[model samples]
Target: MTSPRMIQIASGKGGVGKTWLSVTLAEALAAMHRDVLLFDGDLGLANVDVHLGLVPTLDLGSVIAGRARIEEAITTYEIPSVSGAAGGVKFDVLAGKSGSGVLSALTRTEIAGIARALSRLSERYAHVVIDLAAGLDQSVMALCTPDSTTLVVVTDEPTSLTDAYAFIKLLTLQDAEADIRVIVNFANDREHAWRTHAALTNACKTFLGIAPPLAGFVPRDNLVRDAIRRQTPILFRHPQAKASEAVRKLARDLLVPLPKSTPGPVLRRGA
Candidate 1:
């Protein structure tokens, strides 16, 4: 079977809407009839379940503790249709335990094991969208493979840009040819988003001799906040919202054909 395309969503700092993008992007892909799995890769402080308001009995923690198989940790989330419209999109989610730091305390070998498991799990789906933990920690970097496309989410804040540069720099050091892309979140408009992307791209070009192209951008929208508060995806709660529209456009862009390549082996490093 053809391996699923792995899309890793990462950010330099937290609160840049990385998790939200991950959820909505997966939903958008599912809406397009592609099989998708939203893997919560934030082992230390996972909130993907919280964002979706899911209370799974088994989670990644269960897999790490040997209480459950990796497959057993997956939970299917289906959006409810409104007014008896066609059934809403359905996708699978591999939730992570929130609050408990047990998964975070795992050794490097254990982390690599989970990474390998994820790579194997990709065979069953068309796409695997991993929402990585914020920052450039060892565990976070270990999950990043050169074969996958990494979407580094950034905002206009100075700190956000600096931290993004740091994360990109590390990736470049690890693999100069890594497929890294940028996504501008909470931008005022397209022009503003491009400007933000330019700032980061220019720095990368000058310092690292590489400029990761912009995958897309999401404009600031009030409905996004409402969806998060309600523990629902904006695409379902307000499909016509500005942010939802932007995300759908981004998802469409991603569907375009690209050169196929074999996935590299999972990165194995000590934590």
Candidate 2:
């Protein structure tokens, strides 16, 4: 497998602003003029495109059903410039299949196909961020599993902490080689965020026998809520806001990371 730039955004619980973070990162990258693509691998509750107010022109549904190839389904969105990356970036994305429908766990063949398609996209985009579904599922594991940089977003809440621990435990059971980036959202302050992160790390180290580091945290700000309500990104709404700054840092870290061997070519459903 040839390596390509692969990024996975995930969380232990829903409603932790995971989608918001994913879209924000992608939007920020686009603003910076970096070739970017955000894939919605959260098939069960696809909202990445919805958050952007985009219709499901092409979705993983079509790709899975043989109606379309995954690459052919990618949609290019023009980022309204507030300006982000100085190096230059532009990008597009492919939305995942959204349904109550259960995704039959992909066989090795299906996994290979999905990986191949993603690798091709990576070759084109400087960064590809995938928004994975919340919690433990075969889909989540396959979409966010070790081969890519897996970013798990959390918050300072009992529920969030519990789920974050759960996720680390699950990841440890399955695989530990992933570049696990833990982000604490809605942080009251840096200290608050670090405390939450410390708890998670302690659990991982004490119980899971693994080391997953805190990537960063987005300060709790009204800008995030307001932007979503305004149907604009917070990074756009308040370019200088704390949340925007946090996202910028994350985008930079992701943009130039050591590349992974490109994923294999996607295979069409075989007879």
Q: What is the lDDT of residue 199 in candidate 2?
A: 84
RMSD (Å) per prediction: 6.2, 8.4
Candidate 1 achieves a global lDDT of 0.86
TM-score of each: 0.92, 0.83
In order of listing, the candidates' clash counts read: 0, 11
Tens digit per residue, CA lDDT, model 2, 1-271? 2323677888879999999998998888777776778888776778777677677676777788789877789887655544432223346878876554544455646755686778766877767888888987766766654567778899878888788788767776677565676888998987788788888878777887765766678898888888777656677668889999989977765555343442122111220
Model 2's alpha-carbon lDDT is: 0.73
Error of 2 at 254 (Å): 3.3
Of the candidates shown, which would achieve the greatest lDDT relative to the real structure? 1
Clashes of 1: 0
**Residues 80-123, candidate 1, lDDT per residue (tens digit)?**
55443535689999999888767887776778888899999998
Worst 10 residues of 2 by lDDT: 262-271
